[model samples]
Target: MRFPGKVERHAGRARDCGRHFTKTLRRAALAATCASVVALTGCDDKQQVAAAGPPPAVAVTVMTIASHGAAAQIDLSGRVEPIRTAEVRARVDGIVQKLLYTEGTDVNAGAPLFAIDDSDYRAQLEQANAMLQRALAVQTNAQSVVARFRPLVQRQAVSAQEYEAAVSAQGQAQASVADARAAVTLAKLRLERCVVRAPIAGRVGRALVTEGALVSAASATLLAQINQLSPIFATFPKSNTAILDLMDEARQGGLQLSKDIRFPVQITLANGRAYDETGEVDFADLSIDPATGAQSVRARFQNADRVLLPGQFVTGRFRIGERQDAVLVPSRAVALNAGGASVYVVGADDIAHLRQVVLGDQQQGQWEVRSGLATGERVIVDGWQKIAPEQRVRAVEQHGPGPGP
Candidate 1:
């Protein structure tokens, strides 16, 4: 029921629609092909990345272990003390008449220090002498009577009993004279004590008693103090555990203790200056202190310059022994953790391996390896914290004063 031209137009529109539909299908296929190609390229990139190895070798500084002589040493805080200390005391009861020596001066032994009032002692001595003379006169008279009575008794002019009485009287008179002589000697001794002298040769401190002050002999009143400073003492505390460990090491032939066990000691003053003279260990306490678990060690030093003073504190370095085959590393190379101490050891393959080390003594920024390390092994001195165990590293050899031969 339509015209032939209208039908042809409709047919043409239908043909155009078919062609557009075909073009749309072709564009959709091309888009899919492009998406597949892009996906395949992304997969290949991931595979390439997976084939690559561990990140990169970490850079670290390492030290090589070797046999060398290392000193077994420890540093401790010490207190200065005088070799000998004497407390000057009053020996007699009297008023102090004069102080002979100046305060804070050195005095020789037997030098006069103080003088006390001696009037009473002098009077007592005089009385004793008079008593002795009177007793001597009485004995002479008794002896003459005995001589006269002895002849009379033999001639029957006196009774035997009377002669015996005369002899007894002579004996009593002689005893009195002896007793009086003893009293005189005691009085003289008391008088000598009135003058107080230095009991030792050393430096004396301030006078505790002044002129006119009363001092007592029975109470042993302290007048002053003297301390010998030329040969001084330095006392320091050492840990008992450390002592035992050193002994054990020595016994096992790992350490060579000094002969006679008299270790050498050196001290640094509180002002950070080194002492001129070195000291030797003189005395060590037999027992350890319960509170501190430490042993007291005393060293003697010749302080000719009198630079060291009592009650001053100093730092002491004690060299107890030496290790023949000692292995040492920098203190920075050691890492302390819950399992005690550890370090990073680099192997021949340049791989950093964590090693548990038994530490002995530390000195001059170095630590002595007692166990868990051997010779020719390289230990990481730097960049240890930046690496993990069994990780490859670019080890840089450290030089200058090390455990190397």
Candidate 2:
């Protein structure tokens, strides 16, 4: 017969085992359901992505590129300079007595600019004049003696040695007179220099020396500066490499500069405004500067309003030459990166293809494509950023002169 405690313990043991098994089953069922839901979500996401299909064709504005005779222009950094400049300085030693001109005003060539102490100069000039008069009196008396001796020597009335001596004395007196005359001329020049004058017509700066200030001719003391503002010069440097390339291109008959060789230039001031006057390249250095490896170029512009100033920074656009059968595209259409300059070309299949282009001069907001593009090719100028290379695009012809010529 079984004991009552033992049978109850066995039954409790069996009930605990059944409860543990039920918990295990419920946990496994919940985990399986969560896994199934995650798998279905992943399948739906992939199907949605697949159903979306290829990306929609990007809409872009394109231009059908064709050859046109466009003016070739190159922009270079430049500085505005006066066509003529002069330094007003003391030419004779004296104390500055008066400033004859109004500072910062325009003056004509040889206009009086300053007045230096003239009392000493005048005294020296008078002394020279007195000396010259004395020498002249002596020369006249010696000439009369020579005239008497010349006739006496021929007539043998006087000793020949005495007549010869008298002739020599006249020549010495004449030479002394000439020497005095030279002294007088020098004195007059020195006196004139006491009144300083403008050496050139230009706008003069402030006087460096005031009244009573001593200036030295030996040191060439600077008194003021003047610069011609009208018909000013815009000086710039052109790259030596560019010059060489241009020469080569010219030799190959691929480019033609202006017939007169005076390249037309346009100036842009520091304020980002175009100058009213156009200029021409008047001078170019014969050789490249060794330090900078650039050729110095000068352009002259009529600055009637005195807008261009000396040493002012500016930009110069040089119309160097023209190219035939050239391809051009809007500047904005080209993208520059580490790889190089490239543009989006829309193929006949309506697919945008990235094309590498060799660019020449950029004129009027348009780039001259030297290579990598041909006539009849459509280049995407607008909405190019939205598409990738070889991607289909809906090209619409751009209206108006979008960027420039």
TM-score of each: 0.69, 0.79
lDDT of candidate 2 over 1-405, digit per residue (tens): 869999999999999999999999999999999999999999999999999998788889999888887776788998988889999988899899999999989999999999999899899999999999999999999899989888888889999999888888889999999999999999999999999999999999999999999999999999999999988899999899988887788788777767776898998889899887889988999998999999999999888988888999999998887776778788889998998799999988999889998988777788888999988889999898888889999999975337762
The C-alpha lDDT values of all candidates are 0.91, 0.89
Tally clashes: model 2: 0
* Top-scoring candidate (lDDT): 1
Worst 10 residues of 2 by lDDT: 396-405
Model 1, 1-405: lDDT tens digits are 759998999999999999999999999999999999999999998888888856889999987888889997888998999999999998889999999999888899999999999999999999999999999999999999999999899999999999999999999999999999999999999999899999898889999999999999999999999998889999999999988887898999988988765788989999999898999998989999999999999999989988898899999998987888998888888998888999999999998889999998777778888899998899888899998899999999986435422
Model 2 residue runs over 4 Å out of place are 1-17, 38-55, 129-185, 239-241, 270-272, 287-294, 399-401
lDDT value for model 1: 0.91
Model 2, residue 273: C-alpha shift (Å): 4.0
lDDT of 2 at 51: 98
